[model samples]
Target chain A: MIHFLLKGVLHDRHRSLLPLIVITLGVALTVLGHAWVNGVLGESFVMSAHFSTGHLKAMTRAYAEEQDQMPIDLALIGVKEIMDELAGIGEVDWAPRIRFGGLIDFPDESGSTRSQGPATGFAVDLLTPGSKEIDRFNLTSSILSGHIPTREEEALITYDFAEKFHIQPGDRFTFFGSTMEGSMAFGNFIVAGTVRFGAEALDHGAILIDLTAGQRMLGMPDAAGEILGFFNNNRYDQKEAQAIADSFNARRSGSTDEFAPLMVTMRDQEGMAQLFDYTHIISAILITAFVLAMSVVLWNTGLIGGLRRYGEFGVRLALGEEKSHIYRTLIYEALLIGLIGSVIGTVVGLALALYLQVVGLDMGDAMRASTMMMPSVIRTQVTATDFWIGFIPGLFSMTLGNALSGLGIYKRSTAHLFKELEA
Target chain B: MENKQIIDINNLVKRFPIGDGYFTALQGITLRFVAGEFAGLVGPSGSGKTTLLNLIGSLDSPSEGSVVVLGHEVSRLSHRESAALRNYHIGFIFQTYNLLPVFSVYDNVEFPLLLQKRDAVGRRKAVMEALDWVGLSHKAQSRPAQLSGGECQRVSIARAMVKRPELVLADEPSANLDAKNSHHIIQTMKRLNRELGTTFLFATHDEKVMGYLDRIISLDDGRVARDERPLCVNEAQSDSTAEENGHARRQARI
Candidate 1:
């Protein structure tokens, strides 16, 4: 019976051709859709982890509350000691950064402040060979001007800021801001280079300086606003990272120090939590819609095929083939179609995803005016789920399609069919 | 009905609903058929021969009376039970030689045995033997579309006899064939009947088919009009009594 059915399907080009084509195209779209959704959401998360937030961040409660204000007085003290503990954990890599804002003064040969403008400064450990800051900013790819700062008092400014000030490498500048003690503090530095952050908000009036220079200028020893910890696995899964943060904080819940540091995962950050939640809901709705539409089309295909074979079905019934057996065989034939089609579709979809990942689609032109932290080229992110996600809709929709359509056969009486055969 | 009969029909009446009224296709069809008997319900169109054959095969239930084959009432059989009856005991042949177009001759012959869940070896042996009986063993691999009308009817006969069924019901088995093929098919069925002692019941208006039957149950206007049994092949072939009855039939028709 199986051999008979298989031969019938494979040899009957007229009946099988359209269903196979529909199944193949439907499965291909299903595979591609899953990969695209997983790619967009997964890449968005990793991008956020690398630039705006680490997998987890630790800071004093007061510092966290006033983090938007860049309050140096509320910054974590003994930053090296806290970072040492975080770094000892196998899954964690810690980086200390001082996010502060101040006025940058361009000095003439007279050593006086000639022109000044408000600038945001990120003081990071750039001298370390494997430092997280360099990778996080992807600074190597953004060097539009000279170079990243190698000297203690050298700074890397944004191309916009440099153009605004007509600044050049080796040009002298003075950074002036209030110290943690509310007293006067200032430092002079040479411009090292200019760079673009690939984000409109970050590329304007931004400067990068070494950590030691900022500490000296702030007049606050061993102080950083926060210690960012990245998970070594690089997935930065929010739920897992949040659980780890909760565990870490619980261990220090009895600490009497009012300024004690607390841990927060990436999900705790503003503007990101809602985005994460919406990603799942939107992907589910989109996937459901696609599956339903494809399944319905396949169902119609099965129904039309069944109608075309009405005589064959009637003959089978006359030959004493049970109704259930006929229905089951119909579904089995559908499964064969789905199995072949899904393999073809998955291969094509995976090929497309690989192409996008390796040779990313450049969105630079569209992104120039955008303030979001996403990179211009949005590459597909293939998770383990993408490997077999297509079968859910491919096999199921077709199986369900044929099964639903075959139900009409049961409704037809064998007597009626046998009589119809007489016609 | 005789106690030793393989199939017994008692007061069977079949009606098909047409619009608001019922069209009586069979009325009070009462008959008993014994083992090894080659019988045919001989009649013209609208004589309810096919309807009575359907009841005897358990493919359908009688509207008024009981059709008991092998002691199980056809009217009382569940769908599965009716299917099982056909699967194990009864085999059917159709007018158009309805060979499953997708299957080869061997598969078509092997179909009834497959329903009986016969092992591969057993099915192959039985199918080959039936095809040999029909003298189409050389065309075992050929599909129905690849065969001539005579060959297709021979395959249909092979399919019906492959399982060694106790009762074989044929509805106009020679209707689609020419005189040569029709004679050839009936001779093959007659040989199988004599050699295997399988009871045969045919629903046909074709005189060539009636010429081979050992027993003839003539029907007219949905009722049994005559019952006769020719003692030998010569008597069955001559069938002068049936020819005289045909005159009566025409008179009844007028």
Candidate 2:
């Protein structure tokens, strides 16, 4: 029965070819869309974990509410001892961030100072720099055009910000802020090399100053606002990480009164997970629509062809062929069609992915600069999983079309068949 | 066995709807035919001969009464059972010589055997013998479109008989052919019928077909008008044996 069905399909090759091509193309697009989403999310997760947040982050409860609402005084009270305790935990790689939010004052070309409209800046401890952890922050091959800040007198600014402020390496700039004692302080720092983090937002808005310099300017001593941890690989397992963080908080409640009120871990600081979910939903919708459209086209073509074969079906029935036999033959034909379509679709999808990956997707320079801190290329990457995703949809469409065509055989009656023969 | 009836119909009726009113295609037909007979069902166009033949062939069910063929009530059988009965015991020849255009003449003849679970060797012997009976063995490799009208009809005949069915129902088997092709097909069918002792039931309007049959059943408006058996060439020469048999049957009845 299968052999006969196959022979029939092959005998009508010209008629079946069009629908097969349409279904294959539909499946290919579906695969490419899913691959694109996976590529984006995977790259984003790596960037966030390695460079920005690590597997988890710990910050003051008030600072966790919102960055702007964070109190500058929260770090000065007993947080240093808590950081030491967390670092003592064998599974943790903790880094302290002495970050300050301030505006950079740009010197105009005429040598007159001008406001740079509240440009954000961060100050880190360069002495204890975690080179392995920090290497992930390198988005491009260029070495940021400057040296890291080594003293209170030296600072590093992002290249985009440096260009905007008319500042150069070795130039001096003034920083002003109130101390923790409620007194004003001012200092001048020589410009170090500018860094290009590749991220448009970070590149245009950030200035990096030495940690102690920022501490003196902000008037807080021996305190940092947050501790970022890179847990051992096992600790970073999503379920185990949440459980460990919760247990740690519970233990702190029994051990110390001051640590009880502190926020242990911040989950919302990791936007990468949310981005993954959002892209996946979009990809699913797009792929479904593509498959549905292809199914409709294939079904329509098959239906028309099957209807034209009604006379042949009628003759078979008159010759004592059962309805089941007719149906089985048609279904066999459909399966063969689907198999061919899936193979072609898989090849086409892989080819498309390779082509795009080579040429790259142009998301424009501004968007690239903005998200450059993330490592995924904007182009699609071809993978084995992508081929499967494309192939299944085509197989489904062909099966559905074949089932619909088989129904036409049941519409005929044996008595009417003899009438057709007489005609 | 000599008195057994191969086909029996009682009060058979077939009605169809036409423009909100009912039309009677066959109204209470009652008839029977015995085995070893070449019978003609003759009528003008729309005279209901084809309708009666369809009922006898088990291709349709009679609306009112019983259609019994070969000791089984056809209308009582399930659809699948009826199809099976047809495949096993009945053969059909159509006026259009309905051969599968895709298949060669040999494959077409081999088709009915496929419905059975016979192995390849048995199938090959049966198909070749049937083709040889129809005098079409030489054209076995040609497709239907490549054959002449008479050859195509011969192929249809071979496909029908390859299974060695008990009954063969032909519907206007020569309607598409010229006089020469029609005569050629009729002669081939008659030769196979005599040699194999198979029952043939033909529904046709052609007068040429009526002359060759041993029995003629004329139908008008779905009713049997006349049943007649004519003498064959051999029977006409053996007058003493026929009369002696008739006298013995009458004497035994008395």
Candidate 3:
């Protein structure tokens, strides 16, 4: 019976063609839209994680509250113990970093300052063997000129800062800042390289130095302002990060010291919680709207198709077919159309998504003036959900449309049909 | 013909609504037919011949009185029961040939057997036999749209006869055909009646159809005005015989 109905549908272009095309296009748009949204939001989260937030971060309670101020006075002490303890949490790579403010003075052939500017600096474990900081900061690709620091007393400065100060690689500069204990701090460093991190805020006046140099120059040994913990998989796991933070905080719950250590997940900082929540809500609303709109269009299509087949329905009914049977076949026909259309749409949508994923749109000009830590080129991320997202609207809208249109079959009287036929 | 009664109508009345009032299409119609009788309800338009046929076929119920077809009261049967009666025991042929335009001639003919859930081999044989009976076996794969009017009607007849139903109700079977095609269609039905022993009842005013029926019940203004058998009779004698036969059949049914 199904085979017979299938043959009928295949042979009759007037019945199935328009509905199939509508379904295919609707589903394709849905799949591509979903993938595009996931891609943009996913990329944003990953960039923020790598540059500003790690999967997790640990700092003193007072420093966390005043974190935006880069308060080195409230920094974590005895970082070796914290690093050892964090290693037991899960698959994580822990790194210590110090965010500092200092003055960099370019020196002439003499030992006196030629020019000076205030700068923001990140002191990382650059000299440590097998350190992941180089990869984490993506410094190799961002180098505009020169090389990264290869020895003590060496540092990397931003391309913009170098261009502004007319400082070149292999030149010497004096760094002057206050120590954690509120005393004077001073150092002289050779400019090893110049780099650009792409983001306007970071590339403006940034400098990078070895963690050991930072500790010595700031009169603090075996200490860091903050420690970042990144997942080994290079993807953020919210639940695992939250679990670790909760457990770490619980262990120190009794400590009333203002300087006691605390842990925070990436979402706890930078308003990420609200951003991700909005993405989820938007995705749900997008799919629902698509389904409703497509259903209405397909419903009208089915209504017209049903009206055209009124005579055929009467003939089937007169031949001893129950009204329910005819209605059931309509639904079965819709199901077959939905399945075929969805497969085709998914293939088309996924192909477009894969292309965008490989060759992302470059927004270098758009991001030049932006102070946010967002990447210039944005690409799509196709998740498992994208593979089946189209089928929801495809199958449901087609079935619902045909089911509503088929109600007319029950209202027709076979007697009246026969009378009309006789006439 | 067998003496077993296949359809017994008792004072049947059918009314259709028009605007605010009712238009009576069949009023106080009483009739009966035995198995294997080739019969027709003869009348002009609005005379209710098609209405009476519809009642007998269980496609409709009487507004008053009863229509008992194959021992089941038409008014008392549920939709499923009526459909089952039609599927298993009855067949219908329409004036329009009403073949599904998308289906080929063979599939249209095989439709009833498919409803009966016959096996593939049986269905194929039954459909082919019905097609062969109508001399359309060679055009089994052709769709209804591809066939001429006469060929389309033959396909309709084959479909109606394919199930070997106990009763076949045809409404204006030759109304859309030319005289030559009409005669050919009526002849095909008559031959199927003789060969299959199926009770054939037609609702038609066409003289070509009347010439082939063994029994004719003529209706006028929704009432049975004449009932007779044997085509070549004197007008006065046929009228007198129709009255006597109708009265005798009503008495026998009571």
Candidate 4:
């Protein structure tokens, strides 16, 4: 019986073709949009976590409040104690970092000032064994020339900054900055390499140095501005991070020290919560709007088709087929159509999404002046959920349309059908 | 089997709603049909023949009185039970040759058996037999759209006869055919009636269809005007002629 019905549907172009096409195109568009949005949100979260916030960050309460200003004066003391305590926890790695601003001076052969510029500097534990700082920053792949810092006085600057200064490896430069105690500090550093972080905000005028060199130059012994904790899997979990933060804060519960260590999750940072909420809302809106639109179109198609087949249904009813049986058969046919169309649409949509995932879209020109820490090239992320997401609207809308249309079967009386037949 | 009563209707009245009032289509109709009888309800358009036929077929319920077909009360049967009765014991042939356009003649004939849940082997055999009876075995693979009007009607007959139901209702079966094709369709139906012992009922005013029926029940203005058996009328005429011959011989002897 199903075989006969399938033949009927396949042979009758007027019955099945238009609805199939609509379902296929609608499902494909829905799948592609979902994956694209997911990719954008996932990438944005990863980029923010990588550059500005780790999975978790710990700093002094006073410094955290004014952390955006790079308050070296309120930097945390007894960093060795915090590092030791953080290291005892499993499934997490702790690293200390210092963010600072300084002035650079280039000298001529006659020992006179040639040129100078202001730059932002980041210092990490470069000389420590088994340190993940270089890999975490992805500096190995970002290096345009020369090598990473190998000594306390060695440093690496952004390739763009290097080109602007016409500086080469092994060139000595003077750095002038303030220490934690408000005294003027100075140091001479060798340019060991050049690197670019790909993000415009980080690659414009950036400098990198060893933690020991940074501590000595800033005159901040046994102190650090912030300590970052990264999960072993390199994926951020908001709940877990919050729990860890709560546990760490509870240890210092009621203390009056303004310089006490405070921990915060990545999502607790400025503007991040709104971004995630917007992403969720956008995904919901996009899928819902597409589904409703598809349903309306398919529903009209079903109603028109039913109207055109009034004679056919009349014949079947007169031939001893019950109205309920005919209605059920129509539903089965629509589901079959939905299944076929959804399969084809999923394949087409997935192919397009996979292409985007493989060969990402470059936004280098757009992001050149932007300060946001986002990658120059954006790629979509495909998850397991994308595989079956299209089936929801495809099957649901087609079945719903046909079910509404099939009600006409019961509305028609057999006597009227006979009159219709005679006519 | 010939005397077994298959349909019994008493004071059956059917009405249609028109503009907040009733348009009576059939009124005060009392009739009965026995098995193996080739009968027809003959009337002009709007004379309630089709309405009476629908009531007997259990397609509609009576507005006034009772209708019983195959021992099941037509007016009392639920939709499902009514459909079941038709599916198992009744077949219908239509003026328009309402064959499923998408299906071949073979499939159209096989459909009723499919509804009967007959196995595939039985369905194929019965379909071929019905097609052969209608002389459409060669056209079994042809679709209804590909066939002529007569051929399509032949397929319709095959479809109706495939399940070998106890009763067949044909409504104006020859109305859409030409003179020659009309005779051909009626002749095929007459042959099936003689061979299968299945009762056949028709709602039509077509003279060609009436000529082939053993019994003709004429209806007018939603009421039965006359009931006549043409063959029985012929037998009665012969008996009167024999009695007249005897009277003339006796008078000559006196």
Candidate 5:
């Protein structure tokens, strides 16, 4: 029976070609959409975790609440003790940063503020031979002009700010701000190198200084605004990260009398979990809509096939073929077409997916205008689920369409067969 | 052995709806056929020969009477029961040679045996024999559209006879054929009837078809106007013994 139906489909290109093309294109589009969504959203999430926040971070209770305000007064003190304890943990790397804001003075040989502007400052560990923080954010490639800073008295400033002040690589400047203890704090630093941060917010007004300089300038010894930690592999899972954070806190409770520091995974930091969930919901809605609309198109295709072949059905009935047999044969033909179409579409879609994965679509222009610190190229990622996801809708909707179309055969009266015969 | 009645029609009436009224195609028609007879119902255009044949074939039920084909009370049988009666006990050949256009000649001939659930080996044997009987063994792989009209009709005949049914109903089987093809078709059917003892009934006005029938039942205005035993040129009879022992009884028709 299957061979007979296959021959009929292969023989009648006029009747079967249109439906086969439609099913193939529909499945391909569905698979491409799923792969694109997973790729773009997955890359964006991982980039955000790597650059701005680590898989897990630690902050004092008061500091975590107002960390976004760059409150150096609420910073975690005695970070050395916390860093030592983290060293004993498994497969983790920790980095410390002092995020601050202060005025920078471009003095005119009189030791006075000739031209000054407020700047948001980042104080991170420099390459004291090898700083994990330098590699974590990939700051080396972001240099536009000068060399990286290696001394406590030298720093990297944004090229935009350097250009505004006509500051050269060896020029000196002063930063003055209130310390965490509410006392006057001052610093003198030479411009080491100008950098382009690539990120929109940071490129416009950033000042990077070594962690030792930031601690001295803020008048807080051995204090950091935040401690960021990532796994050795950098494959961050939110649930796993949260488990580590919770277990660390539980162990800290057993020993500490000083309100031991709290750990929070990246998702818990900024209501990011809900945002990630919404992306999945959007992807699901897109796939469901495509399936439903594709099913209706195929249902109409079945109806058209049936109406065109009413004469054939009549002849078969007159020749003593049972009505059920005729209807069932039509459905089996639809199943065979669906299987063939799905295989073709899957192969084509996967080919396109692999091409996109290797040769990504460049979004450099769009990236320049956005604040995300993501790579300029967006690529697709194909998985095992992509190959089979479209098959569910292909087989189910086509068979249902054929079955619905076959019901019309039962409505026809047996008298119609003889009338057709005499015609 | 040839006296067993396979079709019994009594007072059969068939009507068609015509613009809020009825047009009667067959009214008060009575007919009977036995196991191994070659018969044709002869008529003009408006006569009810084809309608009577349809009733006997159980393609449609009667409006007012009873038809019993192969033990089915035709009007009272369920759709499945009626289809089963047609599938196993009756075979049909039509004027248009309604061969399935997608199937090859071999497959077309094998259709009925497939419905009868014959084994693959038996189906192959039966299809080959039927094709050979119609002298179409060389055209087994040809499609209906590729065949000439006569060859298509032969394929149809092979399809009908492959199951070796007890009854064969043909409606205007030679209407579309030239005289040459017409003679070949009726001759093949006659040989099958004589050799296999299968009952044959036809509804046709073609005199070329009537000349080969063992019996002719003429219908006019939905009535049996004449019933006669016709002389078949292909049957060879011993003249003295044929006349002395009532030759019509040994001829082929009831």
Candidate 6:
């Protein structure tokens, strides 16, 4: 029986090839869609974990609220002592960050004295000695190009900003801002080697400067926003960290009224978490649509062809073939079709995913700047799991379509042979 | 347990609904055929020969009577049981040789064996022998479409005999064949019957088929009109009858 069914399918190979191809491609696409979403999320998570936050992060609520406040300035004098105290505790690894927001002026290269828009700058203590957090955060390479700031003046601008302003390793740039004493202040720093992080938003706007200089420039002396910590293992209790933060807040009872509210800990970095959530929703919608469309296509192709084979079924029945045998044979044919289609589709989809990973999707520069808040080149990362994930939807669609078609074939009455033959 | 009757029909009747009314296809047909008999059912179109064949073949149930084939009450059988009984015990040859298009000639012949529990080696031997008997062993590997109409009919005959059934019912077996193919198919079937002692019942309208039958049952308006033994009895019986008639004629002359 199986032999006959197989021979029948092969005999009609020409007729079945079109549907098989269509079904296989559909399955592959389904797999690819799932893989794409997973790859994007997984890659983003790894980048965020490596460059911004480890598995867990701790920061003051005040630093989280006031984006411009330097975390080192908000730190109490005893904050480092407390951090050291916590560091000795089991699995506690701390990295203190001094965050500051400033602006980068892209010098006009047209010889015109026209003012250009200021690119946003973010300064962090990325090169502290023996700091595992800083080491992890430096995803690309060393922070500054020429050297670490011997004085509180040197800065490292992002690759995007440096490219925009034609700044190099030895070039000096002046920064002017109000001091903490309400007096005008200015300084100059040598340009450092630029670091390239793949993320468009990070590459385009961020600049690194000396934490002490940022503290002085922000006019927050001996005050810091919050201390950032990464645990060796993500076993530290958020409640415990919050409790310590609250105690610090209590000790600073007479602080300025404008002091930002302090927070304790968060799991994921802010930018990464937002991007992941957004992409997840989009991926889900795309996958659902793709699956639905593929299922419909498969159903249409399989069922229509199956129904058309009724005359053949009738003839078999007339020759004393059992209806069960007929049903089994048709289902076997469908299974073969599904198997072939799924294999082809999986291969095609995986290849497409790999290609996409290699040569990333580049939205034009203006659109990239407007939508992504980063550079134009955004490459998708391919993962092994992505291929497997992409393969499933296609395989499922093929099976489902073929099963439904088989049912339609089974529903046909064998007694119709007389009338069918007469026609 | 050694019964002679191969088919037993008791007041079998068949009616079909046409539009809002009923059309009687067969009106109380009661007939029987013993084993090893070659019988022909002759009728014009719409004359109930097919209805009677359908009932006897267990393809359909009688409206109001019993049809027993090979000691089993066919009307009482379930659809699956009927199909099984037909596959194992009764061989059916249709007006159009219904060979599966996907199957080769040998596979088509071996189709009935698949329903049984025969192993592949046994099935192959049986199919090869049947095809040999039909003189189509050379065309065994050819598909049905590749064969001529006559050759296809021969393949169907092989399929029917491969199961070694007790009764073979051929419904207009040569309806689609040329005269030559029809004669060849009839000769092949007759040979099979003689060699295997399988009872054959044919429902056909062909006059050319009448000359080849051992018995003819003419049907008209859903009833048997004439049941005649067209073949001579044994030579012994014929000689005795001739002697008795000659002596009576001499006495009359005296």
For TM-score, the strongest prediction is: 4
Candidates ranked, most accurate by DockQ first: 4, 3, 5, 2, 1, 6
Once all C-alphas are superposed, what RMSD does model 5 give against the true structure? 7.1
lDDT of candidates 1 onward, in order: 0.80, 0.69, 0.83, 0.83, 0.79, 0.66
Compared with the true structure, model 6 gives a TM-score of 0.76
Give the per-residue lDDT of model 5 (tens digit) for A286-327: 767776776677666766776667677766776677889889
Tell me the native contact fraction for each prediction: 0.29, 0.45, 0.61, 0.57, 0.45, 0.35
Give one digit per residue, the lDDT tens place, for model 1 in A87-153.
6554778888888888999987897767899998888888877787887787898778888889898
Q: Per-prediction DockQ, in order? A: 0.33, 0.38, 0.46, 0.46, 0.38, 0.32
Native-to-model Cα distance after best TM-score fit, residue A398 in candidate 6, in Å: 4.6
Candidate 2: deviation at residue A298, Å?
Answer: 5.6
lDDT of 3 by residue, A265-366 (tens): 998876778876886788678756765676676666666776667678777777888878888998888888888888888888888888889887777677
- List TM-scores for all candidates, in order: 0.77, 0.74, 0.80, 0.82, 0.75, 0.76
What candidate 3 gets wrong by more than 4 Å, as runs, is A14-18, A72-74, A99-129, A134-223, A234-239, A251-257, A291-310, A363-376, A403-423, B1-3, B16-24, B36-38, B42-50, B205-222, B225-230, B233-254
Give the residue spans of candidate 2 off by over 4 A.
A14-23, A37-55, A68-135, A138-225, A229-238, A251-310, A343-360, A365-412, A416-423, B1-4, B17-23, B44-46, B133-151, B178-180, B206-216, B225-254
Model 2, B150-209: lDDT tens digits are 899999999999998888999889788886677778777777777777788999877566
Better of 1 and 2 by lDDT: 1
Which model scores highest in lDDT?
3
Better of 1 and 4 by lDDT: 4
Per-candidate iRMS values, in order, are 1.7, 1.7, 1.6, 1.4, 1.8, 2.3
Write candidate 4's Cα lDDT for B1-254 as tens digits: 37999999899888989999999988898989999888899888999987887888788888999999999998888878888888888988998998988889998898888777889999999999999999999998998999999999999998888888889999899899997798789778877887898889999877666656778898999999888775532212333343343354346449
Binned by DockQ into CAPRI classes (incorrect, acceptable, medium, high), candidate 2 is acceptable
TM-score between model 1 and native: 0.77
Q: Where does model 1 sit among the CAPRI classes?
A: acceptable
Cα lDDT of model 6 by residue, A1-423, tens digit: 677556767777533677777876787777667666656665555555544554444444444554434433334344455566556544556554455444444333463433333444444564466645445545345343455444556666667677677677766666655454556545566665576555665676566665566666666554444455555654335566556545645755566644433434433346645665676687778767777777777767767766666666655555566767766766666667776777787788778877877676665454535433333444455566555553344445555655666564446433444446545
Measured with C-alpha atoms, the lDDT of residue B210 in candidate 4 is 63
